[model samples]
Target: MKLTPLDAPGYEKVVYAEDAESGLKSIIAVHSTKLGPAAGGCRMFNYPDLETAKIDALRLSKGMTYKNAAASLPLGGGKSVIMADPNTDKSPELMQAFGRFVESFGGMYTTAEDVGISVEDIEEAAKFTSHAAGLNKGAFASGDPSPVTARGVFLSCLAALKHAFGRDQIEGKTVALQGLGHVGMYFAEHLHAAGAQLLVSDIDAHAVAEARQRFSARSVAPDDIYDVEADIFAPCAMGAILNADTIKRLKVKLVCGAANNQLADDAAGDALMERGIVYAPDYVVNGGGIISVSTEILKITDEKWVDRKIEQLAETTDKILTKAKALNASPHKVADQFVEEVLAN
Candidate 1:
């Protein structure tokens, strides 16, 4: 395993690891440790090449650092990415090998579920190391973190709504969701229960069908979702959908979603700002999953504690919006400032 510390300012450290037996190659990027121990999820993906995986890991880890600090969690930012096809490459032995790789870090990084990973998979990884979360255990169970993450996104949606429409209630509003996966479904359920109209889409037809029946969502084609007429656009799928082209087609006034690394590039946030769209930083609103899992790791297993932290996300969102408005800067810039302040101290 070769570990490299990126010379990038604001990012404290970065490391890459690989295991041959499981055909697993991973990059563990630790962006900061000023707040607390590094906390992030382990994402598994089938990258076209190692360079792409490294870039993904580095970008995600930096996002995690900003995310934890913005969410006011006593944790730093770090992430691990396994370069393998989740569809056919996952196995008990492979997961065990990954866990051992995690253990090699000596507790410097704690991991939970992310894309292409499940709670059960996390459990499999736990057998090789105790740093894994989402396992059923004594006095606490680290089950799925999506619901908690969705709650944070929901609250952030409200914050964005209040900023854009001057209303806190979604009762008569419409939200166009771009994914119906775990976090998206949870977000849709909450929004539907609150009497909000939901327009959802996903690459997986079955997931979309389930959401349509369960939440009474109006389904749209995945590619056409951005053009849907709605009060808010919630992108719960992959990142970079907020790039110049998609942003030009969006009919929503506000954008908030659970996906990490939403911006295609740093300049995309400015593009949203220029379009008069109230955009919430993806990292800020998506920290609930990591926060929930980290609380369990610290033995603060109370649901109320998790709820409180999630609720604080709304406050942070409000602050970012306010700062952005006052300074006439993009919310992403305002959020970056907040994270820089935390890391600097």
Candidate 2:
């Protein structure tokens, strides 16, 4: 195992763990444990290079810390990235190897599913340690947090829309969706039912086709979808889409979606604010999935219990937007102040 500290500020502990027998190689970035035990998801990706992987781990872990703190969860922030192709690199042996790597951390960090990782992968990783979520089977089955995550984002978007436009309903509003994966599809269903006009796009043709047929969604090319005239731009696919180029081309009044780390850099949030876009903090809106998994892990089985937590996401989002307006600051800055206050306590 080789460990290197990321040059990025605020990341104090970063390590890469490698296992030869299981063909598992991973980077564990523990950004901060000041709030509580660091917790984040384990994501597997075919990173183009080690440096990219390290940067991703560092950034994601730091985001997790802020996410948990902002949500008032009793957990710090950390993340793990497996350097492998999710399509061909997933195997029981590989998973077990990754589990062993997770075990090396003791109880310092807990992991669940992120991009390219499934609930089954979490189950597999559980074989080596108990620091895993989405493994309960009593009432609400564990693992696969996308539905809850999508629910949170949808609700938060609604709250942001209400605060920004002085309306609680999305009726007749147009929403341009940029991903048709699990979370994206679920979100589209919610928005469609709310009478929002849906325009969809995805790298996967089948997903786009399915969304188009089911919702009568107008299909746009992935790159061109950002330029579509819509009331809101929902990016459910990958991160960094809210950078200078995409933001410059954005034709929406609000940017709220399920994508993690949507802003390529912190400055992008300011840019969105400057453009008069209401930007809901991604981590705050997308925390429903983790909150659900956390409840399941703690053996809270009532369906309403999870629903209540998920619904509160909207309230939190509303508060952030309201406070931002009151302070005449960007929503991101407002959220940061909220998180800083939480962490301080």
Candidate 3:
């Protein structure tokens, strides 16, 4: 494949790797390394085409840059995406090949887990590259970031509720939660314990069923999740669900969740604002996972430090929403501006 100019000109590196024998095709994007080596997760998907995969890689890597900066990590931003279904296409040979592909970066980009990739998969990658994180090898090795990420999202949602409803209470509120992944399940538990009603959906039937049993969550068809009438719409699934079409269908007052690149484009965020919907920027609200994994990478034993930072996510969310409301602008734009200011200094 020939090189095409990434619309994101600020990216430092973009790599495409293929091993036909192993059926491995992947893209790695390092958006920045100003603070330190770029670090993010490796995600697997069944993208329809290489261009689509490249676009997702570029967008997500850029989000990582902002996410790391906002989370105050000394690391920069990077991401990798394998263009194959993790369930059916993953293999030991493919994992090892992807590991070697990551090793080729020579520590410039370190990785953990993301959607469709797990800790076991990272262990396989770690065999070929020390750059892989979230391993169970040492005392400080972070195992899974989903719980921490869920906590951060929960905090941010409370912040959003405070901004939107003049109170920070979760009791008696109805939440339409899309996606029942690890983070989403934990988030539902948080809300359910707080007396919030949950309307849940996921591509994984087992996950959806589990959420229903665990939290008494009402199940909705995955595609129909957007139409649920609730106090908040939490998108824990993939990106771009808050576009023009879905924005019009939303019956919620606030939008908050763990999904990166939630807005299809900047305009989608603006559209949310025009419609009087409060949105918590995905990167800001979902920094806990990276914060959790970063502790392992930095070899820090201070759980207090991690807790303190995660707690501050509420304040961060409040600050962004307040500023956006004051300016009649999208929180997404406010978040980008905030990240730019952080990156600038």
Best-fitting candidate, scored by TM-score: 3
- Model 1 quality (TM-score): 0.94
64-163 per-residue lDDT for model 3 (tens digits): 9999988888999999999999889998888888898889888899998999998888888888887888887767788888999999999889989988
lDDT of 1 by residue, 156-182 (tens): 888878889888889989999988878
Q: Count the backbone clashes (under 3 Å) in each candidate.
A: 1, 1, 0
Looking at model 1, residue 230 earns an lDDT score of 94
For model 2, which pairs clash? 134-143
Ranking of predictions according to lDDT: 3, 1, 2
| Local accuracy of candidate 2 as per-residue lDDT tens digits, 1-345 | 343444656775777777777777899888898977788888888999889998889888988998888767778899999999988988988887777777777878888888888888888888987777766444545657888898899889989997668887788999999998878998999888889999999988999989988888999999999899999999898888888898989888898999888899889999999998999999899888778777754567676877887788889899999999888898988888889888887
Worst 10 residues of 1 by lDDT: 1-10
Candidate 3 clash pair list = none
Model 3 RMSD, rounded to 1 decimal? 1.9
